[model samples]
Target chain A: MNFNFINLQPYSNPQYFIYLMIALIPIILGLYFGHRFKTYEAIFSIVFLFLIFDGSHWQQGVNLLIWLVYEFILTFAYQYYRHHGKNKTWVFSLAVILAIIPLAAVKYLTAFPDNSIGFVIGFLGISYVTFKTVQVIMEMRDGAIKKVDPVTYARFLLFFPTISSGPIDRYRRFKKDYEKVPTRDAYITDLQYAVRYLFQGFLYKFVIGWFFGTYWLPKITASALVVGNANGGLKLSWWVLAYMYCYSMYLFFDFAGYSLFAVSISYFMGIHTPMNFNKPFISKNIKDFWNRWHMTLSFWFRDYIYMRFSFFAMKKKLFKNRIRLSQVSYFLLFLIQGFWHGLTWYYIVYGIFHASAICINDMWLRFKGKHKKQIPSNKFTEWFAIFLTFNVVCFSFLIFSGFLSQLWFGWK
Target chain B: MDTKQGVLDILNDLTGEDLSDQMDENIFDNGLMDSMASVQMLLSLQEKFDIDVPVSEFKRAEWDTPNKIVAKVESLENE
Candidate 1:
C-alpha cells in the first residue's frame, strides 16, 4: 500500500482508460478461464473507487460512502419488512421518500447562495445511485428481488464503470451477469463488442464531442452573444441555432460515449449491462427518441414512474380519457426528471417541452392510426418524420443545456 | 380455449405488434408492444378473468410469455 494516490474521474479521459484497461487484465483473464475472481474484483473496486473518491474530491467519496451505507441499510430494512409478506403500501412509499432525501437535499442546495452549508452533503453520482437504490426497493416490493445478498447488492450499486453517469442496470439483469461467468466464446463476443464500443466511445466523446463542446460550442455561443449585443438587446440568431445543434451533438456524443465505456467495462467484467443509445437522432417521433436515447433512464422512468403513476390514476379514475391520463403521466414523469437534472428554469422547461412533445406525438399517433390512408407512407415522409423529430429533440437539448438562460437572461 | 387463449386473443387484437407467433417471447422488450399496449392488455385481462393484478406486484418476467401469463392467472385463481 505504498503507492502514491492519484484521483481520476472514471472514463473521463483516454489516459484513464489506459490505466483501467491494464488493471482489468487479470480480471479479464479470470473471466476468460471460466471464473470470476470475486476477491480481486472487490479489491480493485475499492482501489479504483479510492482513485476516484480520494484526493481533493475526497468529500464526494466520503459522502458516497455514507450514502451507500445509508441506502444499503434502507433497502435491507425494506426487504426485511417485506419478508413477512405483510407489506403496506404506505411503508414502501415512506421508504422510497427516505431513500430520495439525499438527492432531494442536494438538488435543493443548488438553489441556495454559494456559501450555503447544504452544498457539503452533495456528491457526484448521487442521483444515479439513488435511482439504483430506488429501483431495488421497487423490485423488492414486487417480489422481483427475493434475496438480498449485501455483497452482490453493493457490487451492483458501486459498479465502478457506471457509478458515475449511467445506462442504469436493473437488479435482475446485473445480478444474472454477476452470478455467472460467460462462456469463453460468449465472452469473446462481448470483448469484441467492448472493443468496438471503446473505439466508438473514444471517437464520439474524446474526438467529436471534444471538438463540438470544447472547440465549437463556445465559439458559437460567443457569436450568438455578439449578435444579441448588436441587436440592442438579448435576441437569438443563426449563430444561436448553430449553438443549439452543436451543444445537442456534444451532449449526445459525450454522454453516450460515457455509457459505451460503462457498458464496455462491464462486458470486460462479464456483465452485459445494456446499451444507452441506439441511433436516437433517426427516431421518427418523440416517443421513439425516448425509447432509443438514454434508454435505461427512460425505461426506468417508464417502469417505475410513468406506468405506475398512470395505472394508479386509471384505477382511481382520475382522468376520464386515456389520452388525458397519458398526458398527465408524461407531465409528471418529465417534470420529476427535469427537477432531477437540476433546480433551474431551463431544465424545468426542457422537461415540460418533452412532456408536451410526447403528448402531441401521442395525438399524432392516434390521428395517424385513424387516417392511415390519408397520410402517405413513403421514403419522403419517413425522412421528414426523422428530420422533424431530430430538430425537435435538438431544440429540447439546447434548452436542457441551459444556454437559453445565458441567451435570454445573462447566465448567472 | 381457456383464460390463456382469452388473454392471447385480446393481446393479438390490441397489441399492434405481431404476438401470435412469439408466444414465449419477452413481449415488452422485443419492441413488439409498448406501455400503452400493456395498459390496455392488463385492463382486458383483469376484466376477462376477474382477477386483481396489482401493478406494483406484477413483474414483467412473470407475465412476459403466454405460458407465464397462464401460470399467473392460474396462481391468482388458486389464491
Candidate 2:
C-alpha cells in the first residue's frame, strides 16, 4: 500500500485529520506531562509544512524558503534599528513597504493566467504569514516588541495548524503560549474544547456546508441564470435570491467550519488561537457583523490599517469633524479589505457595498443615539435589525460570490 | 488629578456612562467600548496623559477594564 503523504493540503478533507491526529499524539503526550519538546515540535512543524508544499507544490515550497529568509532579515533589521532608538517614520514606512512587496506581487500575479508569470512566487498562507510579519514589524516600531527572538519568531510564523487560512494569531500572544506548557487542568479543558470544535466543524463543513454548497448551490445557480436570462435586462429572478441565501449559508458554514478546525487544532497544541466567527448572521448591524465575523482579520485591519490611517489623517487635519473622520476611515478600511480579497471588479464592488452599508448603519446609530425617544426601542425592532442585517450581509456575500458578474455579463 | 480618574473620565466621555465604580468590569464585554471607541480612548489617552499608546501595543485583554487602562497608561507614562 502506497500513501501519498506529500500531496495532502491542510484540512482539505477528513482523512487529513486522521494523519494529523496520528502525528499530534506525541505532542499531546508531551503537553499532558507538562513538557514542551521544542526541538521535536519544530521538527514536527517543518515536516507538516513540508507536506503542504512538497511534491508538485515544490515551487511554492521554494518560494516559502526565499520569502522566509528576506522577511527574517527585514524583521531583524527593523528590530535592530528600533532597539538602537531609531524611530524615523520614513524608515518604518520603507520597511513596511519592503515587507509587503512579495505579498503585493503575489496578489497582483494571481489576477493573471497561470504560467504567465513564468514561475510561481507564492506559497500557501502567504497572506496569513505576511499578516504576522507585518504585525511584528509594526509592533517593533511601536516599541511594544523590543526583543525579537529568531527561533520564536520562526515558530510563530510557521505554526502549521492555522498556517493556511488562519484565525491570524498575534506574535506576542502566540510566543507567550508557545514558551509555556499549560497546566494539566488547563490542557484537559483545551482538549474538551478541541473535541467539541472538531465535531462541530464536521457538522458545519461536511454536513451542512455540503448540503448548501455542494448540493443546492449549483442547481440554484443554473435555475437563476436560466430564468434570469429569460426575464431579460439585469437578470432579475427569485432564483437569484435563493442562490444568495444558499451561497451565504455555504460561505459561513464552510469558512466558519474551517476556522473551527484551525482553532481546535491550535487548542490541542495548547495555544488558544482566536476564533474567527461568532454567530455572525445574528448580528444586529453591519458593525456588529464585522466584530463577529472573521474577527481576527477584521481586528487586524482595525488595528493596523483603520486606526493607523485614521490617526494619520487626524494628525494631518484631513477631517476636522470626528464623525466625518470615522466615516472616511470606514470607507478606506473596507475598500482596502476589498482589494485585499482580489484585484477583481466584483470583489471591489463587494467591498464598496459593505462600506456603504456600514456607513449607513453608523448614521442610523448616531441618529438613534441623539433621538432616543423618537426611535422606539423594543424586541421587535431588535429582531428587525437582526433580520435586516442578515439580509444585507447575504446580499453583500452575493456580490462577493461574483454571481452578479456572471448573471449579468455571462462571465466571472 | 491622577491617571485613574483621567482614565475614568475618558471612559465616561467615550461610553457616555459613568465608569468610576465599574473599574474592575470589562468595558468591552459590558458593551461600553468598541473598536472605534477604543481608538478614541487611545487618542484621548495621548491627549490627556501624554501616554502614546500605539495601536499595536493596545491588547484588548490588557486594556479591557478601566483599572487595566489606568495601569497601562501609568506604565507607559513612566517609560
Candidate 3:
C-alpha cells in the first residue's frame, strides 16, 4: 500500500495524464475485448478517487465519502417511495431539495468561510455529482427510470473522467454504455476520437489555454487597469476589449480542453459521453450560442429547469402572452444558472445580461420573421450576425471572467 | 380532420416544417422542435381543440413525437 506518489488535480497538468493513461490501459484493453471488467473498473475508480482526495485534500475526500453515502441513501429511499409508496409531488420536491441541500450549503459556505468551523462537506466536483444525482431524482419522477441499482448509481456519480467538470452524462445513457460493450468498429471510432481529443486537449489546455490564461490575460489586465487608473472611468478601453477576447479564449480553451479530456477518457472506457461544445463562436444569435456553448449544462438546464418552468407557467397561464411567459422563464433560468456559477454580483449580472440578450435576440428574430421580405438574408448579413454574436458572447465572457468586479470595486 | 392530423398541424406550426412523414420520429429527440415550442404547441392545442393537458402530466419522453402527442391529445380529449 505505497500511496507515496503526489496526488494531482485531475487534468491540471500534463503529468496527471501520465498516471491516468497508465491506470486506464487495463480498462481500455478490457473494453477492447468483449469484457467490461466491472469490479476492476470500480476498484480503479476508487483508487484514483483516493489519490485525488487523499493527500493534502484528504479532508475534502472524507467529505466526498460522507456526501456520497448521504446521496445513496436519499436516492434509494426516493426510488423506493416512487416504486411502492404514494406519488406525492411534495415528496419528490422534498427529495430534490434534500439532494441539493449539501451542495447549496457548501456553495453558501464558500462566501462565509469560517476558519473555526472547518467541517464543511464541500469538495471539487460536488456540483457535477449533485447535478447527476438531482437528474436521477427528476427522471424517477417522470418514471423514465424504473429500477435503481446502488452500485451503478455510485459508479455513475463518481465516474472520474467527468467528475470535476462534466459533459454531465445522463444516468440511463451512462448505464447503457457501461453495461454494453461497443462493437469493434464503433470502438475504433471512439478510440480515434479519444486519441484526437486527448492531443487536442493537451494543446488547448496546456499550450493555448496556459499561454492566454497565464501570460496574455494578465498582461492585458494590467494594461487595462492602467488605462482605468488614468481615466477613472468605467474601465472602458480598447485594451479592455482586448482583455475580454483574451480571457474568453483562455476560458474556452481551458474548459473545452478539460471537457475534451473527460469525454475522451469516457470514450476510451467505452462510455460515449456527450459533447459539451459545438463551434459556439459561429452562433448567429444568443439563443443559438446557448445551443452551441457548454452544450450539456445548457441542455440540462433547458430540459430540467427552463423547460419545466415554461411548462408550469403555460399550465397556469401565468402570462396572457405566450412570449412573455417564455421571456420570464428565460430570465429565471439564466438568473439561477448565474447563481449556480457563484453568488457574486458579477455572476448574477452575467446571468441577467444573457437573459436580456436572449430576450432581445428573440424579439429581433420575431421582427425579422415578420419583415422577412424587407430584411436581406444574404451572405454578408449572415457573416455580420456571426461577427456580432462573437463579440456579444466575448463580452458576456468578460462579465463571467470577473474582471469588471475588480475594476469597479477593487479600484474604489 | 382527425386528432393526429390536428396534432401534426400543430407540430408543423411549432417547428415551421411540413412534417408529414416524420410523425413517428420523436420531435424533441430528433431536434425538430424544443420544449419551448412544446409550450407553444400546448397553447395552440388548448385554443384549437380545447384539450387542457396538464404540464405535470406530460413528459417529453411520452409526448414529444407527433404521434404520441396526438395519442395524448385524443386521450385527454376523451377524458
Candidate 4:
C-alpha cells in the first residue's frame, strides 16, 4: 500500500473541517451518551496532531516532542520540589526560566535567516504551549497546583483543537472538563454551540477574512505604497488609512474565525475551552479592547505579567503611588507583548503606543471619576468613546502591521 | 473585626460602594471591580490580613463574590 503524506494546517479551508467533523463523530457520540471515550479521543488527537507535523513538517514535529520532554521534566521536577515543602523563590525563578528557555531560543533563533539554525527547533504553537507550561509552573509556585499528573499534563498540552494558536485553556480547567463527561442535555447544548461556532467561524474566516485579507489587503497595500512614495516624507496618505482599517479588519476576522473553530471543536469534545474574541471592535477604550480582544492572551498577560509585576512593585515600594506603579506595569506588559510579536522596531513601537494609550486612558478615567457630574455620561459620549477607541486601536494595528517600516525604509 | 467585615470594608474602600448586603454578587460582573481594582484589593488584603495572595493563584471565578472572598481570606489565614 502506498501512503501519501500531507500537511494540513488547522482550519485552513472548508475541506479541513469536513475531515475534522468526520473524525470527531465518535468522540461526539461518546460525550452525548454521557461517556467520554478517552482512549479514542487520545488516538484522534494524535492522528490530527501527526497530520499537522507530518510530511515536510516532520522536523517541527520532532522539535515538538523534544520540547514536550523538556517541559514535562521541568514541570514535574518543580511540582516535586513544591510538594516537598521547599518553595524557594530562586528555585521557582529557575523553573520558570527553564520553562521559557526553549521558546525564547526559538524566537531568537527564528529571527535570523531560515537556515541559520541548520534545522528547525520550535514547533507550531510553541508560544502558546510555553504560556501553558509557565502558567502551570507559576501556579505550582503558588501552591494552586499541588500535583502534576503526567497523563493529564500531556493531554492538556497536546489537546489538538486549540494547540495551534489557542483560546489558552489552563491546565486545571482543562483537567476538570477532561475528567468528567457532560450530561446528555449539556452535551446537546455543547453541540448547539459547536455548530453555531463552526458556522460563524466559516463566515468570518472564509468569507469576510478572505475578502479583506486575500482580496482587498493586497490592493490597499499596493496603493498605499504607491501614494506614499509619490508624496514622500513618512508617506502620509488616505491609502495608508485604508490599509490600516482593512488590515485591522482582516486581522480580526482571521484570528477570531480561527479561535471560533478551536473553541467549537473543543466544545464537541466536551471541553469548554474559553472564547478568544468577544466583539473586540466595539471596545470603548484600549483597556476594554484588551479585555475583549484576544481575550485569552490578554488575560494571561494581565494575570501572570501585569498583575504580578504590580504586586511585586507594590510590595517592594517601587513607586510612591499606585497610579505610577500601574503605569510602569502597563509599560512592562506591553513591551514584552511587543517583543513577543517579534524582534522588530515597529512591534516595540506598537507596544509602547498601547502602553501610552492605556496610561492615558487610566488618567482619563481618574479625571472622569473626579468630575463625574461635569463630564456627562450618555449615549453620545459612549459612542464617541467607542469611535475614538476604534481609531486608536486601528492606528496601533497599522504600526503592528509594519506597513510604515516597509513604506519608509523599504524593510518590514 | 471578623474576616467578613474586614473583607467588606476593603471592598467598600476599593469599589466605593456598600457591598455588605451583596454577599453573593459578582463584583466583577457588576462593574464594581476591575483589573485595577482587583490589584488594589489584593494589596489591601495583603496589608490588612498579612496573607500571601499570589496573582496567579487568584482565580476570578473563585473570588468573585464577597462571601467567597471572605472564605478565601479565612482559608488563607488558616493556611
Candidate 5:
C-alpha cells in the first residue's frame, strides 16, 4: 500500500460536516459509556472509539488494527507464561526482542535505499506505546503487577488524550485511579486546568515557537553566516549563544506544553497520567536535567533498560578486577539510552558526549570530598552550566534534525 | 565506612546533624532530605560503595529508611 498524507482540503469542504458528525458519534458514545460504566467497560468503549477513528482512514485503520492485534497477542502470551510460572527471564527477553522488532523495521529497514517495502506503517505514538507495553509485560512477569482485564488494557493503550504523545503512565497508576473515576466537581477543576494548559500550549507552539522559527532563528543564522565569512558558517557571538539558550527554552516549553495538555486532559477523565517535565531548566547538572526533563521517558529507560543491563553486567563480573563497575554501568546505560532515541552516528556521538560528561562529573565529585568547595556555587557558575548544557542539548538536536554533517562541513 | 554505621555516617555527612536513633527512612520520604540531600546521598552511594544508582531509583520506597538503603548498598556491593 502506498502512503498518502491526509488531504485537509476535504476537511474544509462545507459538505464534510456530515462526515465530521459521523466521526464524533463514536467519541460521544465512548465518553458517555466511559462515564456510565466501571473501568473495564470504559476501556472497551474507548477502544471502540479508537477503532472508529482508525476506520476513517483505511491504511491507518489497518495499521492500528495490526498494532492492537500485536498488543493483544503479546499480552496474552505474557499472561500465560506468568500464570504457569514459566522461565520469566526468557519471556522478558523475548518481549524486548518483539518490542524492538516493529521499531527497528520502521526506523532502520525502511531507510534502506534499495528496499521497496517502505510503505508507511503508522508510527504516530508507536514508540511510546510499544515501550509502555513492553514495560507492562516485563513488570507483570516480574510479579510487579497482575494481569489487567482486557478492557483496562485497551483503555490504558488507547486513552485518546495520551495516545498521540504521552507522559507514559504505568499500569499500576493507571489501574488505581481508573477504578475511581472522579466526581463532577473534580472533573470541573481538572477541565479548568486542562483548558488553561491547552491555551498555554497553543501560545507556546504558535506564538513563541513560530516566532522563533520564522524570525529570531533565521535572523541569527544570517548574521552568523555573514560574520563568519566561510560558506554556510554560523559564527555566533556569545550573546547569540545566550539567545540560542532561550530558543532551547522555548522548544522545551512548546513540546512540554503539549505533554502537560495531554496529562491534564487525561487527569480530568480520571486517568492519572505521568508528569513529563519537572523544572528541567533549574537543574544544576546534566544528571539532574535527565532526572527532571521528560521524566517518564527517563524513568522508563531506567527501570526497563538501565537497571536490567546494569544487573546483567554485574552478574557477569564484567566490572570486576580492572574497570570500575559504576563507570561501565553509567557508560552502557547512556549509550543504550542514546541508541533508543534513534540509530544514527550523530546520536551515538551525542550519547558518548553525554556519557563522558557524566562520567567526568562523577569522577570530579569523588576526588573532591562532599564538603570541598572547589566548584563555585555562585550565579555565574550556574548560568555557565546552563549555557553549556543547552548547547550540548541543542547540538544533539541538530544531529537529531539530520543537519549536523551539513552544518559542520560548511555545506548549504 | 563501617557497614553497620554507614547510614548514620551518611546522614551526618549529608545534613551535618547528629541523627542518632532518630535517623530513619522518613527523612528521605518526608522531604527532610530535599533535592540537595538526595543528590549528596546519590553521589556518596556511588563513590563509597562503587555502585551506580540511577537517579530514577531515588524514590521513597527504596531510600526512605536506613534499612532499605543499607540493603540497596549491600546488594550493590555483593554484585
Candidate 6:
C-alpha cells in the first residue's frame, strides 16, 4: 500500500551476486567455443543467464526460466513451420495467445488489492517481451523474413541489452544487420554514443524526473495555485507543469539511453540496432508524433497490429458496406494498444482520446478541403496547430500518469 | 459508371483534379500527386472500400498509375 519512494527500493541484495555469477557462466562458455557452437547455443547461454539473474529466489528464477523456455520453443516451432511453407496461422495464433496470458493474468488478476499473488506474477518486462516475441513469429509467418537461425533467433529474443526494457527490435530488420561485423571504429563510435546516452539518461532520471517526482510536484499541488494571487505573483503551479514537461523529456531520454547502451553493446558484438527516438517533441501532429517517438515500438504496433487488423477488416463484408468499419477498426487497434500498456482505466482512456483525435483530424481535413477558402495557410495557423497538439499530448500524459484523479478530487 | 470509369471517378475524388483522357501511370512522377497527397489517397481508399491499403502497397511501382490502384483494389475486393 505504500507508494512512498523508499518502499520501491530496487532488489539489490548481495545474494543477487550469485545469480549474476550464474548468468556470466554461459557467456564465458560461449566465448570459449565461439564458432564451434551455433547461434542457438549462444542464445541459450544468454537466456539462461537472464533466467538465473531475473529474480532473487529460486522459485522466481524457475518461473522466469519456464516463460523463457516457452517463448524459445514457440519461436523455434513457428520458425520451423514457416520455413516448410506450411499453414502455421493456427499455431502462431496459439503462441500469441499463450504469450499474452501471463501478462493479462498478472495485470488484471493479481493487481487487485490484498492479493498475495503479486510475488507470484511479476509483469515488469513480460508485456514488452511477449509483444516482441509474437511480432517476430508473425513476421516470419508473413514471409517478411526467412527462418532465423536458432542462436540468432534466441539472441534476438533474449538479447540482454534489450531484454529488461526494449526498443523492441523487429526480427527481419535486426537479423539482416546482425550477420554483419562492425569495424573497430564503429565500435568506438557506438561506445562513445552509449556513454553519452547513459549520462543523459542518468541526468534525466535522477536529476530531472526524480527531482520533480520527489520534491517539486508535491509542493506546487499543495499550495502554489490555491490563493488568488496578482498578475506578478509567482505561480509555482506553472513551474510544476514545466516539471511535467521535463519529466516527459527525461522519460524519453532515460529509455532512449538504455536503448543506445543496448545497441552499442550489440554493435561491439557486431549487431546494428535501429534508432528509437527521433525528435518526437518537435512533431507537428499526434500521428507524426507517434511516427517519431519510441519509433521501434510504434512501428511494431503499426506493422503487426494496425496493418494486420486493417487487412483483415478490409476482407469483411461490413467493412465493404460502411466507412465506419474502418474507423471502428482503428479505434479497436488503439484500444488494444492502450490495454497492451497495462490493464489500467487511464491507459484505455488515453488510447481512446488519441484515436478520436486522429479521427477528428482526418475528418476536419476532409471537411476543410470542401471549403478551401476557410482554411488558413499562414505560419500562425501552423504554429497554433503545433501548440494545440502539444497540449493534447501533455494532457494525454497526465491521464497516463494517473494525475487526473488529483485534478478531479483535489487529492494530491 | 463502368468499372474503369468508376475507378477514374474515385481517383478524381481522391486527387481533387480531373485525370486526362490519356492519363498514364507516369502521373505520380509528373508531380500530379505528392507524398502527403498519396497518403491522403490511401486513407480515403481504406475508408471508402474497407480495404487495408498499407503504405507498402503503394510503392513506386504500384502507385505510379491509377490503373494499378484500380487493379489492386479489385483484387483486394475479390480476396
Report the number of the highest-DockQ candidate.
Answer: 4
Model 3 DockQ, alpha carbons vs. true complex: 0.30
Residues A1-412, candidate 4: write the lDDT tens digits. Answer: 2236988999997789989999999998888777899999999999999999988888888899999999998998888888889999899899989998998888788778667676767899999999999999988888888888899999999999999999899999999999998989989999999999999999999999999999999999999999899998878899999999999999999999999999999999999999999999899888889989999999999999998878777777888887888888999999999989988899999999999999999889778878978998899999999999999999999999999999999988
In candidate 1 the C-alpha lDDT for residue A377 amounts to: 87
Error of 3 at A103 (Å): 1.2
Q: Considering TM-score, where higher is better, how would the candidates rank from best to worst?
A: 4, 2, 1, 3, 5, 6
Q: Candidate 2 lDDT, tens digit per residue, A346-401?
A: 99998899989988987887788789888898999989999999999999999999
Listed models, DockQ each: 0.36, 0.59, 0.30, 0.67, 0.12, 0.10
Colliding pairs, model 5: B25-B64, B25-B65
Worst 10 residues of 3 chain A by lDDT: A112-121
In angstroms, how far off is B22's CA in candidate 1?
9.4
Q: Write the per-residue lDDT of candidate 6 for residues A107-183, one digit (tens) a residue.
A: 67644665555455653456667877777767666565566677666667766556656768767657765665445
Best by lDDT: 4
Residue-level lDDT for A108 in candidate 1: 89
lDDT for residue A354 in candidate 5, whole number 0-100: 74
- Deviation of model 6 at A213, angstroms: 3.9
Q: Per-residue alpha-carbon lDDT of model 3 for A207-246, expressed as tens digits?
A: 9999999988889999888898788868678888899999
Runs in model 1 lying further than 4 Å from the true structure: A1-4, B12-33, B50-79
Stretches of candidate 2 off by over 4 Å are: A1-5, B12-18, B21-32, B75-79
Better of 2 and 5 by DockQ: 2
Please state the error at residue A11 of candidate 2 in Å. 1.0
Q: Model 3 off-target regions past 4 Å?
A: A1-5, A113-121, B1-4, B12-32, B42-79
Cα-based lDDT for every prediction: 0.85, 0.89, 0.85, 0.91, 0.63, 0.61
For residue A166, model 2's alpha carbon misses the true position, in angstroms, by 0.2
- Candidate 4: Cα lDDT at A32: 79
Docking quality class, candidate 6 = incorrect
lDDT (10s digit) by residue, model 2, range B35-56: 7778788888899987677788
